[model samples]
Target: MYKNINIFTDGSCISNPGPGGYAAILQYYQYEKIFSQGFFYTTNNRMELMAAIIALESLKENCNIIITTDSKYLKEGITKWIINWQHSKWLCSNKKPVKNIDLWKRLNITLTNHNIHWIWVKGHTGHIYNEKCDKLARYAATNPTYNDIGYI
Candidate 1:
């Protein structure tokens, strides 16, 4: 039987394209693992996608996962738009290349290994794990330690 995992994620940016960070909390039964990282230059959406991607990639084996996030962009893009994007060779409705395609591609690849269900929560709405992820992401954003290679 596959282990069931729950992941909560959030991201923050000091500015639209400034210091940013992403955080993910992975829970299995009563055990929890938290991961967060700051980047010197990035966008909030990128950070949001990174949080989910990193969390999925961290799993050691195939498992059933339910990912919770506050970003509609992340949830919608992955669940609703990615199929169209892939069919159009990564172009959006405007015929423009998709933003953060690098991260999107990475996320798509990571997703192939597991069964995932996505849940969306409103930000800062007092949800326990969401609140914790927000605080962790905000703290990491203020103390960036690495470069966002895709952004800079």
Candidate 2:
């Protein structure tokens, strides 16, 4: 039988391109693991993508994973839009390059190793794990300790 893993992720930014952070909660059975980090300067969308990437990368082996996020952008991009984007060599409908291509590429790679089901949850809608992740991301955004290498 395959293992089932539940993951909740969230991201926050102080401003549109200000201090930002991402958080992930991985739950397997009764044990839970958390991952979170902050960047000195970044956008909320980048953080949202990072949260999913970090959570998937943390898995040591292939498993059935249900990743829950509050970002529709994150969910739709990975589950749907990436296909078209990849077919176009990472170009958008406007024939422009996609933003956060680096993170998207990384997440795409990490996904190959597992069975992932993406889920979107409404933010601040009384979801316990989602709320915790939101808090973690907000706290990290307010107190970043690292530079966002991907930020230009």
Predictions in order: lDDT: 0.94, 0.92
Which candidate has the top score in TM-score? 1
lDDT tens digits, residues 11-108, model 2?
99998798999999999999999999999999999999989889888888888999999999999999999999999999999999999999999989
TM-score of 2: 0.97
The top-ranked prediction according to lDDT is: 1
Q: Candidate 2's error at 120, in angstroms?
A: 0.7
What does the lDDT come to for candidate 2?
Answer: 0.92
Error of 1 at 64 (Å): 0.7
Off by over 4 Å in 2: none
RMSD per prediction, one decimal? 0.9, 1.0
Q: Candidate 1 on 10-94: residue-level lDDT in tens?
A: 9999978899999999999999999999988899999899999999999999999999999999999999999999999999999
Per-candidate TM-score against the hidden true structure? 0.97, 0.97
